[model samples]
Target: MNGKGTKARWWARTATTFVCVGAAVAATAPSAFAGATGCNDRTCIAVAGSGLRVESVTASTTWNGDFNGHLHIYGGGIDRNSATGFWGYHQKFTVPVGRDLPNGSVLCAEGWEHTGGGLQLRGRACAEVHF
Candidate 1:
C-alpha cells in the first residue's frame, strides 16, 4: 500500500529466510572433532600418553552395586574393550598403547554399564593431549 509498508515486509521476509537457512546449515554440518576426542563431560575420561600411546581409559557413573561397567577406548586403529566386575562410581581400564601412533590422533571411548534392568550407556567422549 505504501513505501514504508513494503520495506518492512521485505525486511521481515529476509530475516526469516536467513534464520531458516542458518538452522539448516547447522543441522547438516559435521562436528569439529568427528568421532574423535572431547572430554567435556565429567563422567568420561581418556588417558593418553606423551606420544602415540594411551596409558589408560576411565569412565564413571552413579554408584549402583548391581551394575557393572564396560569401556571401549580406541584410536589410531587401536581399540581396547574392557569390563569391570562390579559397578563403582569410577572405573578405569588399562590400554597399553605403544609409541607407533601418529600425532594429532584422536582417542575416543564409549562407556556403558550392565544394570539390573538392561545395558545402559554411561557416556561417549574423546580427548587429545600432546607431549
Candidate 2:
C-alpha cells in the first residue's frame, strides 16, 4: 500500500481503540452518590458520623426549580451548622464537631430547599447515621 493509505488505516484503528476504551471506563465508573436516607419525593440526605463528630454530609434533590437551600447537621449536643447556597441536584458539606458526642447519640443531616422568589415552595428531608 502507498504511504498515505497506510497512515490513514493506522489513524482509523487508533481512533477506534480510543473510543472503545473510553466507553468501557465510563461504564465501570462508580456512581456519584449512593445509600441515600431520609428521602422524600424530591430530596434526600446522607450523613456519616463518628460518635459526637460528623465526618461528612451529602444532600441531594430532584426538584426542578430555581431554589436556594442548605444542608444542616444536628443532634449529639453539637451546635447546628447550616451550609447554605443556591442548590441543584447535590451538595456535599463538612461538619465541624467541637466536642465528642455522648454515647448512643445520633447525628442527623437535613436538606432544605425554598423558592428564590415570592410564594415559596419549601421542602425538607433528613437522614441519620450513628457512630
Task: Give me the overall lDDT of model 1.
Answer: 0.59
Ten-residue segment with the worst summed lDDT in candidate 2?
Answer: 30-39
lDDT of 1 by residue, 93-130 (tens): 65765454555666676666767887776666776644
lDDT of 2 by residue, 1-131 (tens): 69999999999999999999999998886423222356655555565554434455555555562247665656656436455677566544555444444545555555556445533334455544332
Candidate 2: where is the Cα deviation over 4 Å? Answer: 1-36, 49-54, 63-66, 96-100, 115-124, 128-131
Indicate which candidate wins on TM-score.
1
Q: Each candidate's root-mean-square deviation in Å?
A: 10.4, 13.5
TM-score of each: 0.50, 0.44
Clashes of each: 3, 1
Q: Which candidate number maximizes lDDT?
A: 1
